[model samples]
Target: MLAATKRVAFGAAVMALAVGLAGCSGSGGSEADEGGTKGAPGAKKAPGPENAVRLIGDGSTAFTGAQPNITPPQRLKPGEKPPQFVVFSWDGAGEDSQKLFSHFRQVAKKYDAKMTYFLSAVYLLPEEKARLYDPPKHDIGTSDIGFGDTQGIKDTLRELRAAWHEGSEIGTHFNGHFCGKEGGVGTWSVEEWKSEINQAKSFVENWKTNADLPDEAPLPFDYAKEVVGGRTPCLEGQKNMMAAARTMGFRYDSSGIGNQIWPKKTDGLWDLPLQLVPVPGREFETLSMDYNFMYNQSGTTSGDPDEHEYWGNQMRDGLLQAFDRAYEGNRAPLIIGNHFESWNGGTYMRAVEDTIKTVCVQRDVQCVTFRQLADWLDAQDPATLEKLRGLKVGEAPRAGWPAFTATDTAPADRTEKH
Candidate 1:
């Protein structure tokens, strides 16, 4: 699925509005987190009791106790500044000939960062077993992104396990990659979404059986509990998807578009959507995703070879521009999305890696996964968050961080309107 050509087109107007986990300590997820105020630093996992690895159904996943390396989120002190959170996420995550999934994992570790990998379950279901997926509106075994081969499944499984052990999040990109009005996810009923969600989880929970890898070690985390959120295919079907996701205990949803502002709960889940960032030299902004940038710059995956370098730098600089606005202004979390494909001669991958290296190392900046961001949000005072939300995108408080959040007001829960 990583190598498939994505033909979905996102317009700038729609693009501007879209919205779009622990591993154990020292499991070699990343370098030890350096202690910084409000920054989630890398830490060692407390040793689990003997025989803590209890395998789940078909031995595809296991219960491994609390995820390691995650620092318990603490409420912000009266005058504390919020950390500048930068989330790097991937959709339909898998490993193929390009090996982007594994490659990015190493990049995150080297930069002291953790990311969210939204796995498309079809990647684990071999082509011969494709019929196992009953997509909402498509024929059985149909997937626009295609299915995995035996070796692809094994390689993807290796990355998933290591990523979890290293403290990154593993979310669901659902199954079949269906979109559009004809039986696409946009038309799915809440129950149908539920079915798709269940099927996605089932594939992960039973890959050992589906892929005939019976001897493989179970995934280190219980996916049912671990997968708390995801970005939908093509960023479609969010309204009903959130409805279904909330009922399923999802803590967040990233299927919408927004400015670089603080997030709030919508429909009982954190509405953490992808954001609009400048396109560097362009007059207008676009969603902070590689595909959207590619859509606007070259309009196709294979654009002019000469322009590849320029296109990549534009994305990297765009992300940095967004990061700077947040880091120096309202301190809103900068949410970014990407895929494992080497779109535009792997320029997007390079852009992502460069952005990570540049921003994640900054003091008081936490380059973390969505799960960690949600945890931090949950830890903050509602009144403080309300005040933070009042500050518009790229707007900082006049009196500064200390006086701005000095006192908590008793405001009702601020739920976002979709």
Candidate 2:
């Protein structure tokens, strides 16, 4: 039954087309980072420090008490079937004219979901400060995705502040959105990747100094400690990127490809890659992302207006089918990726919003961020995770869960100190 669904979800032709499109461009970040910064500049003072806030780095970010709206993971009881975990993560997150970042924040709140937002550092760095960003293998101030205007930066800051306070995780999508053979991230050396990562962090840590937005409230969490993982632009450079991430104390990487099954560690970090999910009315799987569906369906970002509704339904149904397979069969965590763009006449955005509303409220469903997922994965017994890893895609244990985990017992919760 699961195999049949998989076949119907993705067609061979569709998969081939998506693969080709992926190589050409990706949905995470735009391919236009090659322009100078152009915007008026004036820094606003960061919000006055409160009792809970400890100002850090030119008052751009602060260390507050434990993040609100976050709960420690509880170990699974013996012989218990795992609850379905669904992670809705966005790459290159920023609030632009479309206001998708803020829009989704409200949507997540309505659905009782917590998400990960992979913030591109360039979004916070104003256009005037573009030269401050030294992207590896790219000219200074040269960004394939361009720099943010002052108003855009301010809007992004507001959302980032609110989102973190509301329990969302803020991860980095690195600096530039460079792809392809000519100075693409894939060609960057380990040292170059490290430089990019540092610059990304530096921009977040010193936004006040660079943007001169002193009056705005400092970002609520210590970005240095709060950021635990991120997805790479275009999902490239995982090999060296993972090496850099581990050394830099990152806990996970969500930039690879995988089937709808249990995740495991790679290069000392949780390898929570984007999954292959069903695409309704198709016979081959595509990555669980809005852009992949858009590419496969329209063959362009903006296709025929009349087909938008059908395309949206196809994506929604595909994700739902993928969720059911895990919920009923293997119970692997579902990781879905999206961007802030409104591709295919905003149909993909609508599809994603619909998917979140439908799945997040289901019984035994926990909508969490990658950081939360990693913490939960870490808290589990290694033996139990190993057993879970043994289950193939959509393959449940021959014995029922109770018998399958008969010897297992819930371990004491190991809560981390804030």
Candidate 3:
């Protein structure tokens, strides 16, 4: 989800004048809080206990696509049930896809969690395959970025089949994101949407070429014959996404949310909408201020992870609140879609895990993955899908938005991690 460029400018001013990214201590799953405010240099403070306890209800994760992108008769698509699952997808970031894929598998085991993971063809490298447990224990989903000039679509997913099985499921992450621009944002003609959609479909359906990655520093591989049956990137609205999904032959899409374009007239696409990911108070300014701050502060990005500590903590706290709201309210369960690169095997992922642990154990909360949710939904009658939260105005929250005391002071710029 992209913010307006105009709002970005205002945020830049706040960062430069009010919060010049004063360095704060950084932690990777470690419990530590550094001093944040009160007119002094970055200092250390308490972050409280590891109170990662029950805080919400049913959870699910969706990757761009998973467990064999478009499997052949993989037990007819499950019937519909209550859509309550968690989804986590990622573009193949840099060259650490395997590291990330392996790391999360361990995390999942520890929590007794099952999740669907979307993988770009690039991630199915020899290095990545080597890390996999025999028989492919993890759920592998496919996300193709055809917008990139290099890797071909069929060649991308074919690479996955050659690398691993059982865990592989082909699905589309749409054509943007890993390719840049659009970042999955929309406003394109439906035809343009079809062109990209069809390209992914064609690749997934016909990827039997059995090609190999190019011999280069960043390995680029050819995909085998495979077809993707799902997609979830930048499908912000119902009509656009519905038209696209129907045209593209997608069975489901892990896009949309209660907060995004909602209360739509159509239910053509199955939505695995993400929840309100917490952004930092200062992040709004980071994007707007990156350029100016580089010149102002020793040629560097203005809001490094160290400088944005409080926002991080606050976001972790807020996610718990969000989980609480969704569970306690009449709304359906919260499904999450997070980018692996966003966490990149670091403190951020741990923070999210902390929140997840807190929520999964909650009295009402029952954690699940997109596959799990879809299986549950598939088993139910289609009518149940109509009764979901993202389809209409979700049940109002049990608690009102926290009433912040607004003096004459301006609202502090805010952002949360997705």
> What TM-score does structure 1 among the candidates reach?
0.88
In what order do the candidates fall by lDDT, top score first? 1, 2, 3
Runs in model 2 deviating more than 4 A are 1-51, 408-418
Candidate 1, residues 150-209, lDDT tens digits: the string is 787877888888887678899989877766667767789888899999999999998988
lDDT, candidate 2, at 96: 78
- Superposed Cα deviation of residue 383, candidate 2 (Å): 0.8
- For this target, which candidate reaches the highest TM-score against the unseen true structure? 1
lDDT tens readout by residue for model 2, 203-313:
999888887888877887888888889888777788999888899879999989889878999868999998888777777788988878877787777699999999999
lDDT of 3 at 298: 30
Q: Each model's TM-score?
A: 0.88, 0.87, 0.50
Candidate 2 lDDT (Cα, 0 to 1): 0.79
Model 3: per-residue lDDT, tens digit, 165-217? 33323354543322113322344456655655554433332222212333311
- lDDT (Cα atoms) of all candidates against the true structure: 0.80, 0.79, 0.35
- The reply for model 1, stretches above 4 Å from the true place, is 1-51, 408-418
Q: Residue 215 of model 2: what lDDT?
A: 89
Q: Name the runs in model 3 displaced over 4 angstroms.
A: 1-84, 91-98, 121-170, 176-187, 201-210, 213-241, 260-265, 277-302, 342-345, 361-364, 381-418
